[model samples]
Target chain A: MTMGFEAGQDAFARAVTDPEAALPPGVTSRRGEADAMRFAVYRNNVTVGLIRALEMRFPVARRLVGEAFFRTLARDYMRHELPASPLLFEYGDSLPAFIEGHEVSESLPYLADVTRVEAAWTRAYHARDAHPLTIAELAAIRPEDLGATRLVAHPSAALVRSAHPAGSIWAAHQSETVTPPRAWQPETVLVARPDMEVTVRILPERDAPFAQALLAGEALDAAAAKALAADATFDFGSALVGLVSLGAFSARTDDEDLPK
Target chain B: MTRFDERETGLPRRSGLGLKPEHYQSINDGEPDVGFFEVHAENYMGAGGPPHRWLETIAAKYPLSLHGVALSIGAAGPLDKAHLARLRTLVERYRPASFSEHLAWSTHDTGFLNDLLPLPYTDETLQRVCDHVDETQQALGCRMLLENPSTYVLFEESTIDEIDFLTAISDRTGCGLLLDVNNVMVSAVNHRLDPYAYLDRFPVERVGEVHLAGYDEAQDGAGDRLLIDAHATEVKDDVFALYEHLLRRAGPLPTLVEWDNDVPAFDVLHAEARRVDGALAAEAARRNARAA
Candidate 1:
């Protein structure tokens, strides 16, 4: 009987993941060998191509673990988790979680967080294009309506909170000199692609909640309140300046229709 | 801007190279006399950035062919609407002269496998492929070329020959064929079929483009001459001979030298393109001689 589409694909998928698995029925090499090594080409292509994609998405993770170990980690992840989309950039959404649970990566406790920063950077790189809120746009807003106004974050803006100083760890890998922080400290990474270039910055502890709140679609007052709760000495003016400078906020003409 | 019409701006019957970012500066600086450049559509699907910037600059100077790798047109599952929508947006933005996808499916019910998985050549498959091609043509608002795949294994239940199956799709959906000569060589060698005869029987009249790439040659467990469609090395002598045979028959079709992995410097790809151009020139001279 002819192999159904789903049945054939299922067998192929199984065979690709597990090299020892018997070749699906009716598969033979050009020379008519029942168990052809020719099938390994597909297996290699499927696994290697994915591992390469994962490497591209998580370069810092790959660099930290080195090539051989990262390949092992990537292969392990691919065995169970196939990409839900054809977009390779969007693959490995759950890689940090996978790395966290992977035994090989256990020694590098901070590897997961470093991978999280990398993933966020990738997301920011591919996020939708939007014009960032300008300082002039913020200034034009009436003082009375400032508290009530809901600030929009750029689509490319992303925030990552990690127990280890993952932001600094990821940045150090980019340069020739690697400088670990003096101490292991929690870090909040702000990933934004302003002007179509992905830029990562370590956010202050107090500012993390403020940016997170805005990204969560909170109103200006509520976000500020959260920031104040996080740190008693929170400076709203400087934080607002930093956010605008990094192209975090999105400009809205909501106040345009308001009373003069 | 007026939409690009394929009939008016079809790719020239000359040699082109698969555009890589590494060669961008050289290509822009030299403005090499290559016929055109082709890129994987998925690579440029990201938001506006260097990729688009480079593509825009190169496209302005030369003809472009947007070759898609993840359309999954032959999948048994429903077409990925999101991918299709993204493709449409890209096509609209770029206005590529020719767009093409492979006959093999890379996606299934679970998700995309990222490899061009093989399919059986049966009446059911033929019909399904035709339907998908028709849908894709409608979605892109243009006729796309379906590329032949290089297979490592064959299904026992395959009822039709690969050529006939591909011909049937072209006939049914009015799509053209992207005859990857290396693929024909690889698949033929792997299956122990005559590559020349396969090329002779191929429906070249339906061809819209031609792809030439190198393959890795090794023996399988049974010591059979196995060819891997690895676009890593230079075009092999056998593959080049087949390309010559194809050019003699088809006469200077739009050919692309695809070297994806282990990509060499611009000089290498440029030299390959020049060689193909030399072949095309030779074919043209032969045609002129015959006319004389």
Candidate 2:
């Protein structure tokens, strides 16, 4: 194949950094801007393109950081990390984590949490289509097996725990700009696709502990025990009903591990 | 609303629309009445979605052409792998009748601009282009098409005329030409050269496909007219007139009606594709009658 792994990466770097500094045969380069200034236009255009794509993909995050700050951080992100593939929808999987670690964004401790919520929303929007268990289907499952029958979460189901009102922070930043004071209390987010439309909601602190255990693929008994221990008000009855209604699970199996 | 006549795509040497998402259902719901459907290969890079879904169904019905927008072939650097992988995937899936990209570069030290930016015509650049084309064809595992760009500015350092560069690229790389009639007219007028002069100089025999689309005649803030190939509005009369002129020489080829932004209804796009099919049909009949 003409395209090797190394050449493609190098070419992308050159194209992104200085578009015209190096030229291939038959390609004509723009002239007469005093060499240094010539590349400035292309450099600006490259940064602008990446920033705009990031803005489109993460509107809520951009709104949180405002235009100037977002552009600066987006520029840094693009320079350090190019997209692994052209599938832009899948681009920014690590952005939330990246933002949390950046020293410049350290003051805005909640910024990373807001970004995490936004990423979850994006994932839900393009998640694979699965047959959501109908209300009738759920009603058929006997209540006796409910405790033993593990519920499958929808492919888009994402439960995130944070120390900020990340859902409202992301939601409020949707249309207009605002810099509200971060809540001293922690918040949890539940992103799901109940219907064709994806929705994100804030979870009560009492329900937050269940997220890690479930997402970690722990057994049903262990997860419920963790959830119960974390919050006295963590009602298993309401949580089970909610999980089925939201199509949070793909399929269910008993907590008992089978022989390999 | 209909597939083009069977005879329109005879040799596949014609101008065609770069298929858009809006026209997918209308074009594929029936058969396309035009020569071919050329799409930005990058758009359909998705694993499975509207781009692939519609194109898959349509490619089986008509001759499809793959055009790469993010190749950044004209940049001083080498080809991009991820982009090429996607292109290779599209080519493997569609087995398209033709594949092509511009003499434009849109990548820099930063990342992708995702727009067709201009390149200067220099020997060093030409060698780079040939290498890229050769590499692209090898990666794609297919013969390629190279489209001339409708540039906004000229380089004082450019030694080769656009046509000569295209011809050289073809000779050395064994790639074909996707002659955009409107681009020829626009660039000739913008740079103060005769449009017909370009037609005469280009080796039309190597042209595997043709593209005819609308151009917005707007000047820069200084009022120096810039012919941007917007492809938004109707195919301009001058451009259509030029198409008629080019087709008379280049012979019948696959043509498309490209409208990316502010896409009108599906019927409007079908009508445009039908219009091209009608013209090509008339040309073919005229030749047949002459032979008779």
Candidate 3:
């Protein structure tokens, strides 16, 4: 009974992996001259369906590479990695890293960084949701012990600091929502669900340390120290004002009040 | 209260919409008319947050259904236990009305394809599918419904037809069918098989629910028509016509309109559900007169 089962799977892999292979006995494919043609349809549908799902998750990568080459890249990628789950949307978590080390993509070195930005952007969108502490809650924090206070950032807040100017590449993909970077420099991209919509903002060099420190769960004072070192001219007061406005912090808990 | 209980096997009302994370708010605000909601079970495999919160709120008022896309019952390999454990967790959270998966397989040892893949109808595959279904029914502890998939090609593999394979599984495990009308039409047209004939030959009595969706038609490299099940477009005209044919024959069962990508506003999906209601109502009226 299981003989046909194993035979069928082997036949399926061959039929999908290489379209030119002959169909198994008793297997009839209708599209081409023989069963091979018909099975080709299955191979095409599965391949195209998966590639399209990858394209949907990583549209910027697709746009950056253009249509034809991207399809080739996607096909090659599929050859190596098939889906382990049925949820199509969440399929390609490893493609960003894959592109980083892929030999064929040497020409587009920036592609991997750009893909990372996009991945972080998606992570922020689908991450666990948490309520940002309101202005009233912040007001409750006593100024006397503000430095020792630890703030929990919203779960969706993700910061990606890349050497490549990936922030600009990502921004350019948004059709009507264009914010052309004034200059191409290593930029820190902060992704957050400000309101209902997910927004990505390019961070200034001087202020990135603070955001990075805050992401590491550092207290406000320590994060500020790192921000100051990155740029002496860094304005802690102004940065905090902006970060708070973006719904970046979930809540601030006093150090002494921390659970044992 | 216990997070999830077995009583969740309760069915969503006659009119229910596909639950999407994007539409979490409107669902929470409570659309009493919406009755209940259903989700692709694989989406909520991870722990914590919105998927769980929203499911709890919606499940509280409206009945829920845990529809799945990745069970791969027809695969040559053994059933995936990790996948089943994730589903069991979801069952605890959502307490869905009906739990179901496709009568197809897309997973290989490497990973999942996400699409409901096609299977050859053969004696060997038949035994494999039944065994998988029996295991799944036992693991989940809820009666299951096996959904048919839309296919672009045919297999010349030896023996069995679509209905026969499904009936054999149904006979063995008492699993019901989730007949996707659009799939029938799409597969029938792609393979040049007759839609009416396929429908006429199916085991309608075993159909527990039905599905209606849209398709995009384009010419492949060789000029052969490829009907892609995009689900982004509105339900095709012919598909709706076929759906009416099904409701007339099967009576009023819980039906769904799946529009996954390029999703419009809440009103758009609501209007689509209302259209199904209109068709079902018309069919009942006609059936009543014939009885008279």
Best candidate according to DockQ: 1
CA-lDDT, candidates in order: 0.86, 0.68, 0.74
lDDT of 2 by residue, A128-199 (tens): 556665566666767766554555666778887887777778766655566663666688888876555677
**Correct interface contacts retained, every candidate:** 0.62, 0.10, 0.44
> Could you give the DockQ of candidate 3?
0.32
Question: What is the fnat score of candidate 1?
Answer: 0.62
TM-score of chain A of each: 0.93, 0.79, 0.83
Q: Cα lDDT for residue A69, model 1?
A: 87
Which structure among the candidates has the greatest TM-score?
Answer: 1
Off by over 4 Å in 3: A1-3, A17-26, A30-34, A62-69, A102-109, A133-153, A175-179, A194-196, A218-225, A235-260, B1-38, B43-64, B152-158, B188-194, B215-242, B261-275
lDDT of 1 by residue, B1-292 (tens): 1122335238998898999989998999999999999999998877765678789999999999999999888777678888888899989998988999999988877667899988888888788888888888888999889999999888877889999999888777878899999999999998989999999999888888999999998888877788899999889999999999998888889999999999999999989999999999999999999999
Q: Highest lDDT: which candidate? A: 1
Kindly indicate the candidate among 1 and 2 with the higher DockQ: 1
Q: Model 2: per-residue lDDT, tens digit, B77-187?
A: 778877888788878878877778887776655555655666667687789888888888788877777888886555555678788898898888887787888888778
- Least accurate 10 contiguous residues by lDDT in model 1 chain A: A251-260
